[model samples]
Target: MNRIIAFLLLMTFCSCDFIEKKKVYSNDILDEELKTFNWNDVDEYPTFESCNSNLDNANKKKCFENTLRQILNDKLAKYEIIVSEEINDTVQLKITIDSQGTFVINNIVSNEVTQTEIPQLDSLLRKSLDSLPKIYPAIKRSQEVKTQFVFPVIIKIE
Candidate 1:
């Protein structure tokens, strides 16, 4: 499942322990520039969500559930097919999820110098990412405010 997240930052030389530690404080980029883009806006007050009536108890629950459902649905195939295996090799990857929820191949965070040694696994991992979708729905306040969320991906050996 994590394999599909191609934008994973890794350090092969570093232990999984380091990855765990860094997950908490290594890179600040995701914290600083991990911003959602709002291409254009109108001069007047917001009117988009005005008509989006508040979701009542049942509706609100559905609204939130639907958001997660949509994410899982979009990535289910990738989650199903792409495989990860524990090999004597490691690589780092930085994945970015756009406003639309597309996984961008940002950077390779690898402790391995040559991929030829683990070609088959490398190929399989990369192929799985093809199924990842970029459709992250922004959290709505009163119903409208799309923000960015950064999630880390780890291609664990299963």
Candidate 2:
């Protein structure tokens, strides 16, 4: 009985050693496969140094930032809800902006929690977009540049 038990243990250990490991990953798989299928955003950002390179004053940069912030806040203020509470949420809101500073929201990438979709969240996003003073100030070359901007929107329920 002892000899038979020892032989069975030895066979179990030896059988697994002959098995091969297979690789699941291949280059043929697209990068998007790793990300969620429902979401859409630019894979990267572009630099047009020629347009912004001419900005020589720190005041101008600050002005650009402040102006953009106020514009966004004013738009969001129109919502009567208690948005006084600040929070950060990332959803892809696609923005189209020309170098001249004209901007508009083209589309919004939303959460898929509801079957019919929530319109309140969408309305808030639209209002916030209309408030942007400018997409950006004229760059060094003064040529109109088209760029996609992603907005981080937060929604709170009370």
Candidate 3:
């Protein structure tokens, strides 16, 4: 009987250890979440003062683009560019807005004909961007992030 009782006690303790074993927590969920997250997308687009912050994401982006287009058009309109030949081309402006809300021109894509026709066009665009209104930086994951995009400006001069 004594031997049987000792065997039973040993069995109980071993089974208790097996049943009470702690599970090791893992970060697999976090890793999966990070992998699934879209890094290229921003939660909020950059904005100007005239753009309403309460607007939805799509409208906010539209307002920002429209405001920038209008400002550039107005500035360019002030310059009386008279070309010798009829020129019709689209100049793609590669622009970047830094995390600090500063505007930067990465590149200006224009054909040689356009460049030759308007030598001061590049400088004029740069100056126009320099005089832009204060901008708000884009937001991603609740943090300010830099954004870049290409804006096409059509040049039509008779």
- The TM-scores, one per candidate, come to 0.31, 0.43, 0.81
TM-score winner: 3
| lDDT of candidate 3 over 22-121, digit per residue (tens) | 7655687688878988888899999998998789999999999999989999988999998899999999999999999999999999999999999999
Clashes of each: 14, 2, 0
Comparing 2 and 3 on TM-score, the stronger one: 3
Most lDDT-accurate candidate = 3
Rank candidates by lDDT, best first.
3, 2, 1
**Cα lDDT tens digits for candidate 1, 38-130:** 334311211113223354545543453354344444553354333344534335544444344444555554445234334454454555456
Q: Model 2, residue 146: what's the lDDT?
A: 61
Question: For candidate 2, what is the lDDT?
Answer: 0.54
Q: Where is model 1 more than 4 Å wrong at Cα? A: 1-90, 113-116, 120-122, 138-158
Poorest stretch of ten by lDDT in candidate 2: 42-51
How would the candidate models be sorted by TM-score, starting from the highest?
A: 3, 2, 1
Which stretches in model 2 have alpha-carbon errors above 4 Å?
A: 1-69, 81-88, 114-117, 134-142
Q: Tens digit of lDDT per residue, candidate 2, span 1-158? A: 99999999998888787785766666536564655443332222222223253554564444544555556667767766543434344456676666566667788776554212344766666766564433443333334456656665544333
- Candidates' lDDT values, in order? 0.41, 0.54, 0.92
TM-score for model 2? 0.43
* Candidate 1 overall lDDT versus native: 0.41
Q: What CA root-mean-square deviation does each model show from the true structure?
A: 26.7, 14.7, 3.3
